[model samples]
Target: MSAGGMGPTLDDRGARSLLRTIPVRKGPDLQWAPAEPPRRNAAMPDARTSGPTAGRKRDPLIEPRVFEAAVRVYARAGWGGFTFDAVAREAGVGKPALYRRWSGGEELLVSALHNLDFPTARDCGSVRADLLDYARQWVHWYRHPDRALAGRRISLDSRARPALAALYEEMINRPRTEAAREITRRAVARGELAPAVRSSTLPDLLVGAMSTHWESTPEGSRARLRRTFPAYAETLVDIILAGAQAMPPRP
Candidate 1:
C-alpha cells in the first residue's frame, strides 16, 4: 500500500505511467556504493561511513555503551568489521551519530584497543612481574573470546587495507609496543636484562610472541588455537626473556 492507496488497485500499465512521471536527478553519488545485501564491510576492510565534522554533534556513544559495542564489533567482525553503521546498529542509534566522529572502521578499532585497560609493569616495580601482570591483563581482556576474534579481523584487515593497517599499528600496536619497551627498560635498569640487550628489541620480542600466540591458538575463531593460550603466553614470555639475556653486548 502506498500513500495514494492500495498499490494493487493499480494495474501494471497504470503503475508504469506513474513511475514514468516521477523524476530522478543524476546527483553526484558517493565514492562507495552500498553493496548488495550489505553483508558487513567485508569487501573493503576500510569501509566506513561519514565522520564527525567541525560542526558535527558530540560523540553519540556514551562511556559503557561505546565500549560494549566496540568489543562486540571487533569480536563479531574484527577491526575491519566495525563501521559507523554497524556500531550505530549495535548501540541502537542512527548511523549518522557514529559517523560524525570516526571516518572509518580503523579509527573505531584503535579506540577500542586504547580502552583495553592493560596495567603497566612500571607500577608493579618489577619488569618481569610487570610483564606477568601485563600478560594477565592481556589474557583477561582477550578471555572474552571477542578480543581474539577482533585480533584476527585486524590482522586480515591489515593486509587488505594498508591505511587501516597503519592506523592499527600506530594507534594500537605502537602504544602496546612502547609499554612493553618500558618494561624492558626497567628490567635493563635493574640489570635483569643482559648489558648487550637492545631495548628496541623488547617490543619485537613481545609482538612476535603475542602474534604467534594469538595466531596459533585463536579462540572464537573458525579454527581453535593448537595449544592453550595461558600456557603458551607463559612459555612465550620466558623465551623472550631468555632471548633478551642472549643478546650480544652493545658498547
Candidate 2:
C-alpha cells in the first residue's frame, strides 16, 4: 500500500512466496529420436470407390415422385450436380431410399422420362390430322424452356448414358413406329389404301419426312418445318388418297 515499505506490498510478498514453492520447468522438449525411415504404407481405397454396382438390381418399390424429382434435378443440373444425397434432400427422403430404387443417376432419369407420356391418340378425324395434332403437342413441349432444356440435356448424356437415350427412343421413335402402324391399320379398315402398302413403311415415311432436322440429332436444331409439317400432312393425305383411288379396288 505504501510506495516503498521494505516489508514489501502484498503483491510483492505474494510473488516472492509463490516463486519459492513453484518447481522449475526444463528446457526445449526434444523428445523426438532420430531413426531410419520406415517403409511408407500404401493408401487404402475408400469404401465407395470399390462398392458393388456392376449388376446391382434396383429395389422394385421406388416412388413415382422421387423418380420425377430426380429427373428434373438431373435435367437442370446434369450428372455432376446429381447425387443420392442431393436427390434425397430435394425429394425430402433418405439417401438410402433413392439408392435402393436406382443403382445410379441414369436409371432414375430414364424412368422419369419414360413416365412422361407422348400425346399420340388415333382419332384427330384422320391420320393426317392426327399427326398434325401430335406435331403441335410436340411444339408446345419444345417451346417450354423446362422441357427444351431437359430434352437437350438428356440428349447430350445419352451417348454414355444409354438408358436416357432409351427413354427418348421409347417416347419419340417407338411412338412414331406404333402410330404409323395404327394409321396404316386405319387406312386398311376404311378401304382408303392398299393393305399391301407395308404398315412399317408408312411410319418410316411419315417420321422421316416430318422429323427431318437441320442437325439430324436429338441435340440438333429442329428443321424450320413447323409451317411445313401440317402442310405436308395435308398434301400427303391428298396424295395417298389419289394413289389409293387409282389402284384396283380391294377384294
Candidate 3:
C-alpha cells in the first residue's frame, strides 16, 4: 500500500465491482435524507407493515434496526460496552437473535458499518463542483449526531482492536477511497487536473482533514464549524486543485 494506505490494494478490483452495484446520484443536487425514525417494537416487525417482502424475503427488517442499535451502543460505550447483550437490549431483540446473525461483537460491528450507505462519485461537469458536492455530503454526515459519535468511537478503538482496524479498511475505507480515486481519475481524463497529480492520495488528504477537523474542534465550537463547513470545504478544494495543477508533468 502507498502512503496513508491510499494506493490501490489487492482488493481494489473487487471493491470497484461492489461499488458498481451501489446507486450513484448524478448532477449537483446531492442531499442526505434524514435517518429513519426508530421503531417501537421489541422484536422484528413484519415486513408487510411497510411493503411486500417480495424480493427482500431473505432479509428481515429487523436487521437494519439491529445495525442501528449496534452503532448506538458502540458509539456510547466503545469496545468494552459493545457486547451482544448490550446491542440486544438497545435493539430490543433477543441475544439469540444477534448470535444467529453474527458470531460476535466484532463481526456485528463490521457488518453494521458496512451496512451504512455510501454515495458514489458523480460527474457534475467539473472536478471542483464534484469535489465540493462530495465534501459537503461527507461533512453533513459527520455532523449527524449518531454517525459523528459512532465514527469518533470507532476511530478511538481502532488502534487497539486489530479486527476493527482491518474490517474498517476493508468495509469502509476501501470503497470510499475508490470513490475519491474515481473523481480524480475523471478529472484527469477531462483535463481538469494535471496528469502528474498523485490522485491516489486525494481521498486520504480530504478525509483525514475532515476527520481531524471534527476531532480537534471543541464541542462548543462544532456548531460554528457546521455553519461554515461549506465555505471551508470549498477553500480546501481550491487549495487541492491548485496544487494538482501546479505539479510538473509526469516523466
Best by lDDT: 3
Candidate maximizing TM-score = 3
Off by over 4 Å in 3: 1-60, 118-125
Q: lDDT for model 2, on a 0 to 1 scale? A: 0.59
lDDT of each: 0.65, 0.59, 0.76
Write down the TM-score for model 1.
0.58
For candidate 1, lDDT tens digit of each residue in 1-251? 78777565778998766655433344674343333333565554432544443354555446457656877877887544566777777877667655655676677676675666633334478766776676766666556666656666776778888887898788776776677777777887888886666666765666567766665653466234423556666777787777777776676
Residues 1-251 of candidate 3 have per-residue lDDT tens digits of 67777886658788766554543355776544444446778686666765554443444877999988988888788888889889989999878888778877778887887676543456687888788878887777776657667766776687788988888778776777787788888888998777877667565677678778788889899989889887887788788778777877778
TM-score head-to-head 1 vs 3, winner: 3
Give the distance in Å from residue 187's predicted Cα in candidate 1 to where it truly belongs: 1.7
Clashing pairs in 3: none
**In order, what is each prediction's RMSD in angstroms?**
18.6, 18.1, 27.5
lDDT of 1 at 78: 59
> Between the candidate structures 2 and 3, which one is better when assessed by lDDT?
3
Over 4 Å off, model 1:
1-63, 78-81, 118-123, 200-251
